[model samples]
Target: MLVNQIDTRQGTNSTPEFSHGNTLPYTGIPFGMNYFIPQTTFDNTSWSFSPMSHQFAGIKITHQPSPWIGDFSDFIVSAITGDIDLKADVTNQMGSYRPDAATFNPHYLSIYDQRYETKTQVAPTTYGALLKYTFDEINPKIIIHIPKNGSFILNENKNEIKLLIKNYDSHFNDDFKSYASLKFSNKFISTLITHQDNPKYDSMILSFNNIDELLIRLATSFISYDQAHFALKRLTNLNFESAKKTAQETWQYYLDLISVSDYNTIKMSTFYHCLYRTFLFPQRCFELDSNNNPIHYDLYNDKVKKGYLYMNNGFWDTSKTVYPLFAILIPKEYHQMLLGFYNSYLESGYLPKWLAPDERGMMPGTLIDAVIADAAIKGILTKSEIRNFLKAMLKSANQESHDTRLGRMGMKDFNNYGYLPSDKYSESVNQTLDYAYSDFCISQVAKLLYEDKIAQKYSHSALNYQNLFDPKTGLMRPKDSSGNFKSDFNAIRWGTDYTEGSSWQNSFSVYHDINGLKKLYQNPNFIQTLLKLSNQKPAFKVGGYGFQIHEMTEMVAIDFGQIAISNQPSFHLPYLFEYTDHPEYTELLIKQLVNQFDDTMNGFPGDEDNGSMSAWFIFSCLGFYPVCPGSDEYVFGIPIFNKATIHLPNGKQFNIKTNRNCPQNQFVQKRMLNDQPLKSRSLKYVQIINGGNLDTELCLLPYSKENIELPFSLSN
Candidate 1:
């Protein structure tokens, strides 16, 4: 099964200094409310579960999206065979575990502790999980650690324990709490709840005298303890094996959406693992109530609201590729997500940019505009819903929020100066470019709703990116309030005006008007500029960030020249070659870039950033990518697989076939859609969803031709 084929630790071999995908070995159902990971250390940091670690801390119930964002409502469960002193220091209680023998699948997790001589297995449900422990010695005990302010109640008669904890990073109410209920199969011979002035040391220990085996059914809720109990009912009649099988089936249903036929087992494994990463984000923050209606804890109002809500996603990253994939393969789920985003807008008064349970307001522009616009163009949202979302988009574009993290950073200045001034805001170049693209997306939605005046306004604002374009450098330079480019402009400098990249990586971010950007350059001719970007040495300077950040280190480590595929800003760099006459360059670059990924511990070049990189691989493997989401077109690349099929939600199959697809055949010689010659280096959204065969012929030699039809550009 594809689920079993995935090593959840594919990207766990990473440190803060560098990232090999910087991902946790998360074991849970797709978009489950809670994810379980075998914690290896006592440090409550983001690097909790490293594949290289030998110490077995416990199984952590985490709601953490990224280590950068931190975790919320998190705790640990561990089993010990002998009596151990109850203390706050988890490092002392940690036991040795063989990382090679541990199982880290998406549906299940199993680890053996040498000190305890116990085997612990976990099978996940949507909101809860079934944990089984086999003890080789007597006096088997279960430990539940609450790292912060929390309290627990034990019911000896019911063989259950209820826990409530108040632990979060930010954006939650003061009274915010996470509740959990644990039902044990064996009655406790003795119970001890440790309390200390330092809340980090508090824990609950339950000992069973003679049981050789024990089972723990755990359920968690953001609402109440009763709700947690209600969620636990899902595993009431099911055993560990049954729960594991059900979790596997749940993941298989999603994994079966795309099937690849390739003889290369290694590449096939890599592809499916990338596919697995795609469905692990924007998790359901809502819970099913008594009547099976969805309700969520609204942090904005500090009350439970009746609607669908999702969290742990940054739209600035996912909007590029993740939602586009969803639009093509799973429009139903995409539609529901759109509704959830709209609900967030209704509650928070602006569309979310980064939502980890609530508005993080990270990144530069309100790029969720692209997600909404893509859905609007694809007809995934209703007319009224589109209208409502358009209002939310425009509000963020015009009005500044009281909390800077809730909406666009420099809204008033952007409106006044046509671009964010470098002196006024950090990463102003990225902020300006992102705003322009967002404006273009706003225009798309406005046009769909027949709001011609609003469409014209945003469409005009979309060209504001031209204001910061430096004709001499052929790069997007940062400008001040007086409309002068920054004097000390260095193309290789990272993160002064750009968002995690330098001018070489962030300059060509003109997704809406690539043709226009090209026209701005005459001597280098934009195509030559892209060549310079790819051919130049991977050099960088500590620009705005006085120190070399991890992103800079990763970019240099990958050695992909100035094209830092490790970050999102450079995601569409290779595809930009398609806008030029030399389309074969894109094919060559994509083939080279994809080789960096595999189905191992070091699966990605850098932080996957909530499936953005994974979706990029998925799209490139299928021989196309969504360069401009709101533009309704996918720029062509070279397919990596011999054959693949996408099962669309509309019961149609979009098949992609590549002739002579191997390491030798790196360039596209010819392309056909539904047996007709595809002259343009792009595919329309309708053509994909309607579903037909997309065939391509690959050869080692580069194919060169003039007057090649380019992708969608505003100037065209």
Candidate 2:
């Protein structure tokens, strides 16, 4: 359960509104599933940390502690019994859970949470009839009085308790369905049974689709059957008034960020999706508990653990897309996240590549420089806190011992030099290039924060990536000391010098400078460059479609899998349209990418490094991307939705909308703001700050017109 306020009301117009991103907040309130999988139960699942709503804690879950509850088991069986001296023939259709049926026995059910125990389970004396105690107090003494025909019933002017049964079916592992029924007091049903098991698979499948309907049916059943009586309002928010009020308010907050005027559906979707994407990464580590002590884990291992241990990270790649998205749309959370990262630096020497506090270590390139630098610029973390950490990392970058066993350069010195000097198993060229890029990110932050000297030093360091650029070859070739290409420089095959990708993916890796790279070639060209790269075809296939390989494996060419999308620095590639005047091509790539991949269970189409992979989908869907973070502007592109609402960093909303259908509307047919023609191609910082409506109409045909945004200028 990740979200609510989605108008779950069983009304004539209740088509159930939902956030359409890969990840959305899990309203703690149960929706599709029978039980609420808790935040502590969070994992790196799907798109976000928990794949749940941040307000999940606010949603009340009926805590029923009984032997019938089952998890990671064979099946669920109601342990109810009737002392009516009745004769009955009960089929075993309600399959077995455990061989001994004691796995979920009351006493053994490890108190997943103590709050549930205090709320639901009580002494048999506290409820009604009494029976036998368990082997110790593990078993309950409450007796379910049944009719002569072997049916269960219960109710009184007493313990206002409702009853519900979740028949965990065989499809539990696959399609995520549960066969559940409810009742109030069991007094009205002639069967005298609380809930009967069903072997019918069709009914169970039907029950899963109308999730909201099922919830109402179950709730209504409680009162209708009188087998168990309870009100949905008896719990969360007390009533719909309170819930809807909160939901609308939350919607308003996100809408204000990407303030689109004449709201079309596509613009609305983008804005909201971007807002949703920002929260997907470092999830709700802070959840209120029974005592309300904020019982969530930390993201960066912060002091109070205020932000839970949010451990998904792809340092270099994320710094480019994910972190910048946070910096613009949600700086406060971004601040907290950076603080947590610094904490991780203190705890774990040399920050981390892809890190978890418990060390789920992913890949290499200690690119915390980007985060630290940006944090300093954005005032997210103090310079004093990060300075020492960055300095301390130089040793690992330049002189640290390398271990080929670890899948990185064979020697430590290789990381800092931008090239390994005389190491047999060093990815020297790639290391140097990556190190320089990270320095560029760090420099931007220092430059912004009046640390001119520090920024310049790092900026110069960034230029080191150019050293690998071979003039004759016009590629980022591997070089030896006196400037000679590595002997086994097989541009055709990958070797110890390069990472998983070949020169095609790595050549233009120096993104900070297309011009400098242009100088490296005899003829400067973007289209030719892209066309050539596209034609090269992966020697073994790097990322997405056709031939998939074991992700993160050290294969020569097989790239596209789950982790590649999650990892690589391929995000800003599409926006090259702005620089190259190939906006059409950009639209082509984006449309193909979006239509191809979705929130599937087979991981992401590739490695979704933290939320970087998710961020790409988010920004593209929203019709623009943060081509240059801290620039107060996002490079515009064809949006995939009719509407999108962006939740900006300053707690305001911005909207983007187009003609009804989004992905289908690929061209910018007409555009307006509060019904005015958009004279400027770009949507500026001031416009978003004003918080108004932005309306756009998209077309299926290309306009073949040049409507470039305020030509991208270098901050320098």
lDDT of 1 by residue, 1-716 (tens): 37887888887788898999989888998988999999888776888888888999889999888888888889999898776667545567887899989888999999999999999999999998999999998888888887777788988584899999777745646677889999999888888887644326468888887788999999999888889999988669989999999999989998899999987888788888988899999898999999999998888788888989999999989999999999998889889888888889888888898998888888888889999999999889999988888888888778877898877877778989999999989999998999999999999999999999999998999999999998777889999999999997789988878888889989888889998888889776788788899999999998878898889998888899999999899999999989888888999999999988988999999899898999999999899999999978999999999999999888999999999988988899999899999899999999999999999999989867567788898888
- Which is the leading candidate under TM-score? 1
For residue 539, give model 1's deviation from the true position in Å: 0.3
What shift in Å separates residue 460 of candidate 2 from its native position after superposition? 1.4
Report the C-alpha lDDT of model 2 over 1-716, residue by residue, as the tens digit. Answer: 11221211111110012112222222222111121211221111122112222211111122111111212111121222222222233222111122121111111121111211111111111001111111111211122211111222233532222333232222212212111222222122223233222321111100011111101212221112221132222332223334334434454454355443333443333334334333434432233333444332322232234232334455655766677566656667666666555545444444556542223334445665656655554555566655654554443344443332112343344434545553443556667676766666666665655668867876777677677776555567777655567675555344356565555556666645554555555643555665555445345433222233333232222332211232354566655555555566666666665543343222234444345665777677766776554344566666766566766665566777767554555667666877788745446655764556677677777666465444333322
Model 1 ranges off by over 4 Å: 156-158, 195-199
**Candidate 2 error regions (>4 Å):** 1-280, 283-310, 359-361, 375-418, 421-425, 471-474, 487-496, 535-548, 551-567, 599-604, 628-633, 649-651, 659-716
Model 1 residue 525 CA deviation (Å) reads: 1.7
In candidate 1, the residue pairs with backbone N, CA or C atoms under 3 Å apart (3 or more residues apart, or in different chains) clash, namely: none
lDDT of each: 0.89, 0.41
Error of 2 at 705 (Å): 6.6
